[model samples]
Target: MKITVKELRLILTVDNLDELIHFYRDTVGLETSKEWHEETGNGIILDAGRASLELIDSKHAARIDQIEVGERVSGPVRLALRVTERIPEATETLIEWGATSVAPPTTAPWSDVARVQAPDGMQITLFATSTLEDK
Candidate 1:
């Protein structure tokens, strides 16, 4: 069988976990449904829609693993979200929400598109493919 969705639990290796949390939580507007912590660690799990994106606290910088058949989360690929209408407004707000744009929002002959670098180094693309709408 083939796969359809991606769920990830990220081990957040950062100098400051609270900053990271604010970025993904308030900036990205992800809902924190569950929270777990120990003496030296903490984590917040997002409802994450169809799939989950979990953020964990780590003191040192190391690579994150992704979910495989036998394992969970080998790593994260740049997550892309598809949206309808108010794309320009949404993207603009995203910048205000603390996402640094890798490429500023622009409209092309084919579509309107924008690129941004999330706090977690995730590359996101926003596109308005009006041609394909209402299909």
Candidate 2:
């Protein structure tokens, strides 16, 4: 039988949850769908617009790393976010918000992309396309 999936949520247990929340929600502009600051724990769910799971083999992953970052710097999981435009500006903004720049914006076969390492060490790829048709 085929099981249907509803939504995908990438849950990250971070040490600096507030900092990450600011980086993702405030700086990156993801809408906060829900948040909790009870005695159990503090957590916030930011709406990432849309989500999809991308699987890549080691060879292809390395190739992408080389093209974007000029080195193999990402781990098994990487976050690729599609932006409306201005990848360079967004990348710089992310860097100023405490994310480390893995690479500046570069033109790729698919879109203009930039890589940044989040404060929690998650490698994020920011790609810009004019519209969904362009994507």
Candidate 3:
């Protein structure tokens, strides 16, 4: 048998659902893709640009951590976001909205990245890939 997938989305089960919704929509700037409440529970899906499933093992995740933050994240899950050159300014604004800094902006071999903890306690890496070669 063969299977095909069309779209992918990240579903976060958070204690503060409404707060997370506001954070991702207003703070992180992701538009609301879909939201609904069934008899079971409530769900909110935000449009994280160019969604794709990234399945990585611990070793690979550690490598990514080393490259991005010069260290390893304590958990198995970490969120990665690609932003523009305005990362510093954007990160400052995000911090104002309740995100705590895990690491300051660092220029890595692959991209410039910053590690942060979201209001919901998720580890996030804000990154920018555009280099001098891209200009």
Q: Which regions in candidate 1 have their CA more than 4 angstroms from the true location?
A: 1-12, 52-76, 107-112, 127-135
Q: Rank the candidates by TM-score, best first.
A: 2, 3, 1
**Best prediction by lDDT:** 2
Residue-level lDDT of model 1, residues 1-135, one tens digit each, is 998665655454666667667876775567898888899778777654543343554311122111111123223445544446455676777777677766656654445666666666766656666443555
Give the local distance difference test score of model 2: 0.89
TM-score of 2: 0.92
TM-scores of the models, in the order given: 0.56, 0.92, 0.84
Clash number for every model? 8, 0, 0
Best by TM-score: 2
Models ranked on lDDT? 2, 3, 1
lDDT (10s digit) by residue, model 2, range 1-135: 998988899998899998898899998899999999999889998998767788899999999999999999899989999876599888989999999998989998878999999999999999976345535
Q: How far is each candidate from the true structure, as Cα RMSD in Å? A: 10.8, 1.9, 3.2
